[model samples]
Target chain A: MPAGQAVPRGPRTSRFALRPDERRSLGFILPFVLIELALVAGPLALGFYYSFFKVEYFQLTSFRGLDNYWRVITSPMVLGSIGATAIFSIVALGLTLTVGMALAVHLERDSRWNVAVRAVALVPYVISMLVGSLLLRWIFSTDAGFMAVVLGPIGLGDHSVLANPGSAMAALVFNAVWRDSAFAMIVLLAGLKSIPPSLYDAARVDGAGAFYRFRRITLPLMRLSILIAVVRLLIHFVNVLTFSLILTGGGPNGATRTTGLALYELGFVEFKLGDANALAILVFLFNLILVAFNLLLFRERRRAP
Target chain B: MTIASSPVARPWRRRARSRSAINALINLVIAAFALAPILWGLSTSLKPTQDILVYPPQIVPERPTLEHYAMLFQTGIQTPIINSVIVSVGAVLLSLGIGAIAAYAIARLPFRGKTVLIFFIVALMSIPLPSLIVPTFTFLANVHLSNSLTGLILLYSAYQIPFVVWILYSYFLSLPIELENAALIDGYSRFQTLRKVVLPLSGPGLVASGLFVVTFAWNDFVVAVAMISSGESKTLPVAIYGYLGFYGRDWGPLTAAAIISILPVIAVFVFFQRYFLTGMTSGGTKS
Candidate 1:
């Protein structure tokens, strides 16, 4: 029975028979596997399947091959939505990263006041996106809203930001940055915490200024965290729906209708399940490509270092 | 030691003082930017209907009133609030219950295809919710579970479990395995070691993962909006959205309802603020 000793074979066991540990492990993981297969994997495959056929009122009427995909690809509305999504995601990602990095650097120290400030900064993130968008919508409302009141002294009270196409898109980006910058800050702050204080001290002793220390010591060390935040925020902004839905309503002449909202309208509003599923698959692929691109960029940088 | 008394140290000390003051100022501005909309919403909710539309919007209302809050309840905001609570809590419980088991298996137990399972989970985490919405709705409808609180709970749990497993998997891996080994040597089975020894030591991990799941379930809008159509199963976000159509610029009651919807999440967040960063960064950083 000792290690490296051959055991006496009393009876041959079937190859299909699972060992005790395997059986227990299988039991432990079975429920989660079933849920994922049933809900996540199953729905994803079904959506892919539905994308190939004409679905009327949630019924598969006929196999249309790639017609649905072609229609989605060629649709002007879908093309416009993709353009809008690109603009929103790029701008929002930029602002969110900048603001989050600033906040993280400023509040990295552990103190009572800093803790309170961090909490306050995170308040917007904890609030639901729906409520946050609504709050911003109220603030930007031309009639009796906060922005109106603030701009009144400047003789711009009647000028509604949401009424203008460009500003409406800007407002959507602001809402995203307001809610998600704190998330970026939290991740980056963790990265900052992991760096040893002695490294900063050594740099300071070597006559490195603050900015120099940040460039030399912080940026390289914080690459992984920044990449993590960037990837997460990109995925979020690409897939986000509520900001456009509630804040701008894809409004001012559909200037802010993101792909997510387009998918929503196609599937729910127009009830074009086939077109929506096809678009859904397209958008999902776009998300994967975006994420993959970020990872690849980070990998390249990591290799250089 | 003599450098402390030199003139060179004076400017550095002065610079440090000014830098702290500057940091404080910047912190104030950032906090204000983060909280102004929320405070404005709260202020508007407390103002009288007429005062809400006043030209010089009162940061502090001239006549503060609870009329909006009362009206929100009168229109039956409580039903959606209750529904949200039940669904969120139920989903969190379900995700945590099964996610802990799966995470334990991946972290501690030796099993074939573990790496593949983990890869599948990570991939699932990135699947956009919009892509899954139409199909999930159809799937639930086919199974006769759509538009029900149970359906929402199940859907949310499925979406949330992958995240829960990822977080707890790292946490469990960080935990020392010697305790479980000791328990097993004391005549306990693997499941018993898991329940009695491992779980007892994983309090912080459970709390962190559970809090994340709760936030996800509570803040979700798209899935709930896609699935449920009736007022009977509406969550808080959908209900507040309904106010946009029903009230049509009635800011007072609308802000009040929005505030009501966020109260529970804010409260939980404030109480458990410490756990969130760990929960959030662990999964991302591990990758």
Candidate 2:
């Protein structure tokens, strides 16, 4: 029977009533169910299947079994990209969290100036990654670029930041921080707003200073938000491509090539379809590990009190 | 930084003055950090080629001109711009429509496996894009849907639906269930009740998710590059990449094109600032 024919039942309905509920729910959720199967699950399955076969010029050849995965894992360039991605993620996380926390605290007030400052902070978050990368390239360019113009009078104009390997990595980290810190601030600011003012008032009445109140009250309350922001930023910084791709082309002898950039090169430039697919699976596994850790933190939070 | 200064309270007047002074300085630095690159891009776009090449670069263009921007339109930039608009609008509409129905069902309908469904949606939001691009490209190629705007629209809507459901599901949860019950009792069908009652109340949520979808569809580079090979079907971001590939260090027109690509986002963001923040923060911390 159709669901409308039966009277509405409570949560403990019998097996017959339960059938109608399932049918009605399936009708409601069918669109999303179809979408996930085709777009997400299907693609992921194909990625795994493609990794086990050797393909040359878009034609699949003999089965390679574990050879593609083995080669990808042992390659020196892939190892270097993994190392670079880790360093980039850690350093970018540090800079973004520090700067974002400072901005959130400084601009937390609802005054006219503070509101305007907060609004100004979100400008970079909406701009396309391509646009942001291009803008940063122009800013740090050695030829009549802003950095060159400022550093020229100080006798430092001869060198480009992107020309040196170390500085290029630093520039990549800085660019990541610059692009994402505002988003961090938004999340952190939301956490900050949730803390009750009475807690701070109580702390102040006990002769505690601003530092004491923040250390004693604010930090503990803001831990969950910080974790969320950190996890989100880690995922983004690890996967970032446009900054390194457009600005430095992952160049200066491959110093700034992230795993994402490396994957692009493997798939597009070298046309090693099988190896690229293997690398893509590896990257997905890496992200899955991070997210699993995040879930652990979430469960721990839920179990508290 | 200011917290360190607040401990040594002198006279009230001195304390207030110092605190405000410090706040102003901090705000100035933050604003400059955010706006300086954009302003520099704008300035570079306005300068003639000679001024851009000169040493000790001028902060403001002495004689700003529109030649670079005019040159952009005088060329074939219009095609990619139109492609971007079509994809964004198409993706936003389809994702929001499909997502709304599913979200309403999840929120209101009594269902088994609902918890699992919600978990999958959240998990999908964090799935790395590069991992999927390799397989998605081959799949599209197999079906002969590659290098087409329809292909892009389909992919964008599919990828973005998780996010749309995430935002709208929360909005639906917060709405009172009694409203829906009343509508049902008044003899309105479930679909009619959603159209007449629930959707009108979720206008802010609709605008928020719509803006987010537009931004994602417009700003994507990896998916577009991997999916689109032909210039005729490329979106704005990929077109900008093409300019870099072909023009070889041409800054003037590059900056102009960059400016053009970001204008729509800036306009939408400024207008819907509150809704954007609410949607993002709620989705971030709560979900």
Which candidate number would show the highest lDDT if scored against the true structure? 1
| B34-140: candidate 1 lDDT, tens digit per residue | 99999999999999888888877789988889999998888888899899899988998999999999999999988888877876676667666765787787678
Candidate 1 chain A: minimum summed lDDT over ten consecutive residues — where?
Answer: A296-305
For candidate 1, write residues A240-291 as lDDT tens digits: 7889999999988889999889899998889888888888878777767755
Tens-place lDDT digits, model 2, residues B70-178: 9989998999999999999999999999999899998888887787787677667777676677778767776788799999998888888877887898899999989
Task: Give the per-residue Cα lDDT of candidate 1 at A203.
Answer: 95
Q: For each model in turn, which proportion of the native inter-chain contacts is also found?
A: 0.65, 0.62
Q: What TM-score, over all chains together, does every model reach?
A: 0.92, 0.93
> On a 0 to 100 scale, what is the lDDT of residue B165 in model 2?
87
DockQ of each: 0.57, 0.55
CA-lDDT, candidates in order: 0.85, 0.84
Residue-level lDDT of model 2, residues A144-263, one tens digit each, is 567866677988877799989998999898888888888999988878988999998888889999998888898999998888789878877787777788888887889999888898
Stretches of candidate 1 off by over 4 Å are A1-20, A153-155, A291-305, B1-14, B284-287
**Interface RMSD list for the candidates:** 3.0, 2.6
Candidates' RMSD to native: 3.6, 3.6
